[model samples]
Each structure stands twice: as structure tokens, then as C-alpha cells.
Target: MISSISTNQIKYVLALEKTGSFSEAADLCFVTQSTLSIMIKKLENQCNLILFDRKSKPITLTKEGEELINQLKLIYQEFEVLQEIIQGTNQEFYGNLRIGIIPTLAPFLLPLFLNKLVTNYPNINFSIDEITTQEITKRIKTRELDIGILSLPIEDQELIQTSLFNESFLIYDASGTFSRNKKYKIKDIDVSRLWLLEESHCLSSQIEKICLLKKMDTSKHNLEFKSGSILSLLELVNMNKGLTLLPKLATLQKNLIKPSYIFNLVNPIPAREIGIITHPNFSKKRLLDILEIEIKKSVKPLLDKTKRIQLINPY
Candidate 1:
């Protein structure tokens, strides 16, 4: 009877992809060059396809090999997860939790929670990737990430979202360019003078939704920042006499000791729904619950009185 493909053979192919040469792949795997080559040949024979172009000096994957390599990646990821489950059943939350966080949320959010998370759960290792919102959603859907932290309205029906809390956006007008009004609407502010983070940040999307800046022209003086930390951006606004949006968490951290008048948005105040997302098949319920609890505890003391006044309840 034909045996199924072994993980070792699969690993050999992955190593070859990385090293680009059989000799190097063998060194990485701690095996002889011929052994690595033979195993790859065996895999090719079993699949009845030439995995590598033998004529090529550096060795490139054939079209079929390229496809096979992609499948191998998925398979390897599954294997690691399965192994983690088996090993962790009798232990602590003692495995790598691969997570993706959007660039907008990473700076302020992680600082508040990461220290306690590491100290409390030493076994729960983290492999975090800071990516765009679209990439985070894609990774969560594909099971490439164990969880994702992002803003709400993730339209994928297959994934599950657990709302953490809502972080309100407060207007920052350091140069006193924006009129000191207790309540402001989108039309009240000069669109040209408003500084905003560049596109790809989910905050930009949320701000666009609130201010109706959909097609409004903005000034080139508004620096195009990639992150939504808003701390440095607020500093720039203070120095340069422009206005930008600040998430409650960003304003609360370290700096921002100046006296600036804060205004609230009329009616539906601008807020981003912070939440954790996971796939339906993820089975670490107890661990995730503890993580949620820790996040809430860490986040509470940092919120300002105004930010707390309009609590954006999570859906």
C-alpha cells in the first residue's frame, strides 16, 4: 500500500524553497546534501511531478512545485497548530499565538496590554504581525492568525468578532485654528486645515465616515503619517498650527500636558469599535476570556473623563 506523504519530506521541500540550493537546505535541516535531494526526489516521484527544474543552476520550483509549496505552507501551519493543541492540553496556554493587529491600533493598544499579558501568561507566546486592516481580516479568515484586533464592521460572515471597547476620537487643534466649540459638526471645521492619517489606516476610514470627508480636499501641509498613534501627529499639530483626530488612548499616554479645549461631535460622536476577532473553530475559549478580562482592566484607568462620558458600547 502507498503510504501518505511524511512531514519530513514536506519540510525538506520548504527548506529547499528557503535556501534555494539543495546543499544549503541540507545544512539547515542538519542532513547530508544527498539525503535532502533524495527526499525531494522521492516526494516528486510520489506526486508524479517534477518539483524543481533540475536544469536551472540555483534551482527554481516548477509551476506545479510552486502550487505544491503553497499547499505545504498551509499543511505546515495546521501541523504546528495541532501539535500545539496536543502539547498544551496538559500545560498552560503554552504555545505561540499568532496574531495580526492593524497599524492604527498597535502602538497605543499594545503598550497598555502587552506587559501584563506577558507577565500573567508566560507560556502564551506571541507572534504578532502589524499589518493593514484588509490583511488582518484575510489572515484571520485563512487561520494564518489565531486572533486579530481591529475596528468593527468586519463584513466577513464566517469569522466571529468579540467587541472589547470603544475608543472615542477627540479633536486636536494645537494652534487654536479650530473654534473652541463644545460640540462641532463636520461642516464647522475647515477641511483644508484638517490633518489626517494617510489611507490604509482603519482610523482614516473611521474618521472619513464621521466627518463626511469622503471627497473633501485636504491641504498638502497635512503630513501623511502611516501610523494612527496620533501622539507625534498631535505634537506636529501643536507645533505647526493644524488639527488632527486623537484616539482617547493616544492622548492619555506619557505626553499631552498642555491645556487644549476638547470638543465633542454632535449626535453620533466619532468612535472606533475596538474588538478581538477569531475564527469559529478556535477552541481556546478559557484563554481568550482571560485575555479579554486583562485588556479591559488595563484600558479603564487610561480613559479621559470626556471620553468616558460618551461610552461607545461595543456590538
Candidate 2:
């Protein structure tokens, strides 16, 4: 009976599970609400179990239904893998590649290689999202995302990580508080006048660690502000006479911020290791190789080749 279930039926069920609404799921699956409902009911009848609680307002799966959906997702992923395998055998890269990048890296990093990738691989379909580190790892593990580009080292042992490049951190002092001619050490930073992204961002945490923000006294400032965007952070810094740490890539856009406002860190410069992460069983090696090559080529010339560097952990 299980063998009799069609791929379309599986897709219907998965879509319903994801959207938690018959109408929304129907739209996602490109089917009528009635058709989706009938297919799911049929699937449930065949198994002699009620998969969804129809009485529930947005619809919810039962305990047994949850277990069944878990297995169904695995089966669906395997089907995708089989398709990828066939495409790989043809020696042609033509398939969907779902990519998630952390917000801190997404803005600065995507601009470096996205256009080249899209132009070079016209056959590949790229779906990219700016997601947090935790969400990226979760989606990759669930086979929802093909790859993640973010700062390492992630604690997940199930994922395979490939180091892409080391991006150094620089001080963006809009108030001209720090000397432009000299490299500033972490100890020279005044936490009271420092602004940062909200604590949720990994970049914010990395900055905190590098500057020892937790240990410093920030109570002197009457107004406390934190932003989710580097661009916003820069704006606030400029308006309020505050400073924030920015990744090297963020400072490269000369039109966005003046060269006089950007300052370098002292010797043994703090940097973050950016990398691509994927599940252990991820296929499409050729696609990954090309992506890595293009990204490295784009950023190699932009990044400083100096040997004095210290890698900051994102965790």
C-alpha cells in the first residue's frame, strides 16, 4: 500500500504540513483546495489513520501523523538526491541549489560572486536567502537548504565545512574619535561610545568578544541603541558620533562610507573565517567546486594578503 503512494500525493502532504493551511498548501502545490484536501484524505484513508486534525483552526498533525511526515520528508529528500545523481551523471549542472547565508555575510559576500554565478551557470536555479546561523544549520540538516555560507566554526558535527576565506574586522568610527593614521588596538576602544548590531546577530557577538564589551562599562551612555543592519549601524554611528566594528568587506564600498572614517586594527588583526557548510550526504560536488572557485576568485584580490591574522569564533 505504501508503494502505491504517488510522488504528487507526497508533495501534497508535505506542502500541507509546511503551510498548515489547506488553501495555502493548495496554492503552493498549484492545486485546488478541494483537490489537495481529497488527496490528503485519500492518503490518510489508505493508511487507516487521521493524519491531520481537521477541527483545528490552522490544521495540525497528530502524533502518528508527525512520525509519518518525518519519514515522508526523508523519502522525498531521497527522491531529490536520486534526481541530482542522474543530473550529475549527465555531467551537466542543471538543478535547484538552495543557499542560505547569514545576514552579516549576505550583503557583503553575495555581491562578490552572485552575478558571476548566475551568469556562468545559466542551467542552475539558485534560491538564496539571508538567514541566521542557527536557522541555516537547521535547514541544511533537514535537507531544506543545499548549502550555507557563513562564519565558522559551527558546533554541528553532522555537517561538513569547507573554509572559504578569512575576512578581517575593521573599526568604523564615524565620529572621528579614533585616529585615521594609526591602527587601533581592541583596548583602545571605548565601550561607552560603541554601537553594535542587536545581540542576535553572530557578527555582534563576534564584535563583543573581540572588544570584550561585556567586561567594559557601557553605563555612561544615556541612550542605548542596537541595530540589525550594518548599514543602519553606520548611519546611527555617523549621526550620534559612535563607533562600530565592521567586517572588511563592508568597508570596501567607498560610496557608502568615507575612507577617513574606516580604521584598521593593530597587529594580529581580528578576523572571521567564512566558509560553506553542507550536510555530510550532500551531492553535486561539481557545483560546490565551481561555487568555491568563483567566490575565492572574487574576494582574493579584495582581501589583504598579510599573514598577521587571528580568526574569531562566531559561536
Could you say which candidate leads in lDDT?
2
Task: State the C-alpha lDDT per candidate.
Answer: 0.74, 0.87
Q: Write the per-residue lDDT of candidate 2 for residues 1-315, one digit (tens) a residue.
A: 555988889999999988889999999999999999999999999998889987887889988798799889998999999988876765476889999999888888899899988876778899998988999999999999999999998999889999999999998887777875676888888777887777778898898889866643446666676667778888888888888888999898888878888888967899999999999999988899988999999999999987998889887
Clashes of 1: 0
Once fitted onto the true fold, the runs of candidate 1 whose alpha carbons sit more than 4 angstroms away are 1-91, 178-181, 219-232, 256-262, 304-315
TM-score of each: 0.62, 0.69
Q: Give the clashing pairs for model 1.
A: none
lDDT of 2 at 173: 85
Candidate 2: the clashing residue pairs are none
TM-score of 2: 0.69
Cα error, residue 78 of model 1, in Å, equals 41
